[model samples]
Target: MNIKIGNNNKISSSTIANTVNGNMEFPKKSWYEKHPIIGGIIVSVIAGVILIFSFWADIVKFIEGVL
Candidate 1:
């Protein structure tokens, strides 16, 4: 997280924004062109849904009674 600066240091607003945001705001077409495996998004959404269902109150109560 530490950025080094020499005696000749020049700071730009875009550099600061990129550092804070982790990724640059590139165009969507350019991004997908570079990385086409967008299936990860669908997988992540499915995983989140599974986690929510697994922790639902009725499921938790049923498991607790079984234990």
Candidate 2:
């Protein structure tokens, strides 16, 4: 990603953080506050997906033990 330059032709931290390409832009606090439920659901879904993928073998073993 290219560094973002300000109007003065100097790079600032904020400009770098908020790059035009959108990779560095993350959900800010105000975004969470505005859509708390949506944010919670999104976070929960991401966590659930990660957990399932990371522990698929353990999860299958646990299910087999329960059966």
Candidate 3:
């Protein structure tokens, strides 16, 4: 199949398919494969970081309004 990029900035469909095919074949198990506890800890830490950053913006907005 011939795939064309509209603006010449996109990859061809075959390239995408080839790159993603291996990932699609296997279920993602890296999150719990080696060590469940460590994986959970890592996930929790990442989630906490994201939560903190998310609220940081709100905190900044509140501070701006108050000041």
Q: Output the number of the TM-score-best candidate.
A: 2
Per-residue CA lDDT of model 2 for 1-67, tens digit only, reads 7655677667555533444554676666687898999999999999888887757888889999999
TM for every model, in the order presented, reads: 0.32, 0.38, 0.34
User: Rank by TM-score, descending?
Assistant: 2, 3, 1
Q: Candidate 2: where is the Cα deviation over 4 Å?
A: 1-29, 54-67
Clash totals for all candidate models: 0, 0, 0
After aligning candidate 3 to the native by TM-score, how far in Å is the CA of 5 from where it should be? 80
**lDDT (C-alpha, whole model) for all candidates:** 0.69, 0.79, 0.76
Residue 55 of model 3 has an lDDT of: 74
Segments in model 3 whose C-alpha atoms lie over 4 Å from true places: 1-31, 54-67
- TM-score of candidate 2 relative to the true fold: 0.38
Judge candidate 1 at residue 10 and give its lDDT. 59
User: Tens digits of per-residue lDDT for model 1 on 1-67?
Assistant: 8666654465444344333556778656675566667766767889888888745888889999999
Please report how far candidate 1 places residue 46 from its true position, in Å.
2.3
- Colliding residue pairs in candidate 2: none
